[model samples]
Target: MIQTHRKKAGFQHAGLLLMLLPGVVFVFIFSYIPLYGILLAFKNYNYSMGIWGSPWAGLEHFRTFLTNPDFFRLMRNTLLLNIYSLLFYFPMPIVLAILLYEVRGRFFKRFVQTVSYVPHFLSTVAIVTLMGVLLSPESGIVNLILKSTGAEPIYFMAKPEWFRTLYIGSTIWQNAGFSAIIYLAALSSIDTEQYDAAYIDGASRLQRIRYISLPGIGPTIIIMLLLRLGDLLELGFEKAFLMQNPLTYDTSDVVSTYVYRVGLMGGEFSYATAVGIFNMVLSLILIGIFNQISRKASSVSLW
Candidate 1:
């Protein structure tokens, strides 16, 4: 009887494994398989030699990346960009969602949300082009206004000082409303009874929001923050690369753009791969640190 029970348990475990087959296969193919390519970071890669045949270079690639003159500038730019993004992009969505949640008129709230989210659907190329046209030094709307006021036209895209502002501002404008949808969903899940109690206790609108709504969605916020921390090093290459030029390189050149230049343009595959691995390890460290902090302080963690 015991042998029969064990056989039945084994069959059940096999059934469960079959149910997970697709997901397991997907991760194995896409994630684990690609990890093998990380070996290129330590090798002198050549087109003729291929990945496996490339000669090992020990820590040469890493040494070159770390000692390069541009290393500090690239690291500083990337770090500051992400820090600014975290300061601005991280909180705006939550604030927007809270404001929307407080609105009494459902139609007006939806209309505002719909209009705001429209920017997120626009192609990045189209958005950048529009920005250039609007901020052009000569005939652009912003410059035209400046000219009317007898102030000089600011060459925003070309100026190093403006790059971080433009990039982070554009991201906020494009993503805030769309990103708020998840927060809004979290807000919707809050218990209506809690709000009713607060109201009965003579709590003001702001008070109820402060004590009830904010705390209610705190876990969602913590989770999103953890995820963002995990992606701290991964700024979008398309937008930054398109907007950057030699003049703005001081502020705009980041890890992704550097990797693209070395790997695709300069044909320095090993150096680029090494830099990429460095970024990944840095990101992993930041994620682990923040996850630990979140678990300790807020009792919310992805793991």
Candidate 2:
């Protein structure tokens, strides 16, 4: 009987492993296989000779990127944009999730959730195009309304000062509802008995939220903030590139966009790769510092 049980358990474990096989294969193919490209960062890559055969450049590329005049500008833009995102975009989902939790009607809640998250599925190109159409100086409905109100038409996408506002606001709109999914899941797991106890003690709705609800989701908030910190320097290329024009480069230009222009377009592969490594290192350092503070303060951390 013992021998039979061991054999049955082994088969069950094997079946579970089989279910994970596809995901493991996918990660290996898409993620790990591409890691070989990191070697190009240290070499003056030549297409004719290939990556391995390319002449070694050592820290020459790194030095060049560090010494470049545009380096600080690109870094500043990237950091500031991410900072703005944290300040403005981060709180939005938490607030949305709390609001969603308070909704009393099932159908209205479901409808609102669906509508809010649907924009997340739209392509970035589509979102940028929609912004262009909706904010056009002369023809856009927004500008038309402004003009009718005796105000001057504003070219939102063309102005450097408005770039951060548009970018961050659009990001919040596109992502807040989708991001609330995790918080909602976390909130749902809060014990009902805690709320019951708070209510029986004659606590107000806000008091219950302060004492029970916020504490329940506190760890989730910290983890999400840490994750954001991990990607501090990785402002995505596509949306910024799509929204960017020659006029807005002062504010909109970020490391990823600069990398595309200088590395891919200009064929400075080693230098661009060096810049990427620097950004990665910087992000790592930031996340490490923040994680340490969080761990000390709250006893929760990614590590």
Kindly list the per-residue Cα lDDT of model 2 for residues 1-303, writing each as its tens digit.
Answer: 999999999998998899999999999999999889888889999999999999998888889888999888998899899999999999999989988997889999999999989999999999999999999998999999999999999999999999999999999999999999999999999998988888899998889878888899999999999999889899989999999998999999999999899899999887889888888888899899999999999999999
Find the 10 residues in a row with the least total lDDT in model 2: 205-214
Once fitted onto the true fold, the runs of candidate 2 whose alpha carbons sit more than 4 angstroms away are: 1-8
| Candidate 1: 10-residue stretch with minimal lDDT | 228-237
Report the CA-based lDDT of candidate 1 relative to the real structure.
0.93
In the range 1-303, model 1's lDDT, one tens digit per residue, is 999999999997997889899999999999999999899998999889999998999889999989999999998998899889999889999999999999999899989999889999998998899889999999899999999999999999999999999999999999999999999999999999999999999999999989999999999999998999788887889999989999999899999999999898999888898999999999999999999999998789998
TM-scores, all candidates, are 0.92, 0.95
Query: What ranges in model 1 sit over 4 Å off?
Result: 1-26
> Candidate 1: how many backbone clashes?
0
* Cα lDDT computed for each candidate against the true fold: 0.93, 0.93
